[model samples]
Target: MTVQPIVFFPDQRLRQVAAPVVAFDKSLHDLSIDLLDTLRAAPGIGITGPHIGINLRVVVLDLPTSDAPEFYVNPEITWLSDDKVQNEEGSISMPEISAPVERPTSIKIRYADLHGNIHEGEAAGLRSVCLQHEIDQLNGIFWLQRLSSLRRNRLIARYKKLGHA
Candidate 1:
């Protein structure tokens, strides 16, 4: 698998909802692999299929503590805790820009592996933030939508200044 080009932020593809991954086949597996390569090339911890314009509910995350990237297909949040935490978040598509985003501090999610085996898990802290962010991408909710209007506008201006708008 090879690293594919990212779809870049402000690209409408990033805002379009992804279709559920239906076939647990070679193409899906390859796309997941390519996603990992692309995420590593982008040097980001997490990325979704929409980041590369695939429009499928897939995500890859390479946390600093892990030796390999984790893949999630058609992941859905099952439960969200009342507790909230704010962390500086950015996207592979939107390089050189990040803003503090507040999200549920803990979450329970259900997703499928490449083999189509469904699994449920709970995450907290950084993992929680990453999952929520990527799932939102799958749901057509950009991280900018999680920010205040003023903050979102400022970051957008900065991105434009970076010549990416």
Candidate 2:
């Protein structure tokens, strides 16, 4: 597996919806590995295929609380709790910028595994936030979309000040 170059923010690729993963073959597995490598190299807790310009519905998250990293293919949120929490969220594509994003405190999700088996699971706290964020990327909604326009603009200015477009 290789660490693919990240598709930075403002790139149209990050705005395009990722295509569904139809074939769960060796390529998909390798892509998942590459995503994990890229995520680690990017030094972020989460990343998606769209983040690397693959435009495939895939996400890899390596949370410190987990024993190992996990990959999700074609993941979709099935249910969201009414309880909400605003946590500081950031994206690897838009580095050096983050804003408080309010999302469900818990979520039930359905996704395809590398082997093409469908599974359902639930997550809460940071894990919940990460899944929601990555899934948004798959749906062509950048994390910034979750923020208010004012806050989003301010962060973009800060990102520009940091010498990144």
Candidate 3:
């Protein structure tokens, strides 16, 4: 698997909604492998197709300390718990910044595996947060947008100051 180049924040393609993955074939499998490799190299827990400018609803996640990586195709949040938690969130696109974002403590999601097998499950804690973040990217919502305006501005300013914006 090759490490794909990541599309950074402010790229117009990052704002485009990803198209659903229709075919579960060799190419899709290859893309999933590339995503895993890219995310691993980024040293990030999660990544989406848009992060690499693929424009397909694919996500790869390998939480820190986990032995295996997970791949999701066309993932959608089906339900969110009323209880909420604030977790520090960041993006590979905007690597230099992170801020606490309030999100549901638990989420139910529906997605397909690389072979097009449907799966539905609940996620909590960091897994929940990571799934929401990556799915948001698939839906054209950048993680920074979840931040308050003031925090977003501050984070962007810091990124710019670091010559990464």
Index of the highest-lDDT prediction = 1
**For model 3, the run of ten residues with the poorest summed lDDT:** 63-72
Worst 10 residues of 1 by lDDT: 60-69
Q: Estimate, for each residue in 33-76, the C-alpha lDDT of model 2 and write its tens digit.
A: 99999999989999999999998999899999999998899999
Candidate 3, position 72, lDDT: 91
Each model's lDDT comes to 0.94, 0.93, 0.92
Which should have the higher lDDT, number 1 or number 2?
1
Question: How far is each candidate from the true structure, as Cα RMSD in Å?
Answer: 0.7, 0.7, 0.9
Error in Å for residue 110 of model 3: 0.7
Off by over 4 Å in 1: none
- How does residue 41 of candidate 1 score in lDDT? 93
Any idea how many clashes model 2 has?
Answer: 0
Model 2: lDDT equals: 0.93
| lDDT for each residue of candidate 1 in 35-61, tens digit (9 for 90 to 100) | 999998989999999999999999899
RMSD of 2: 0.7
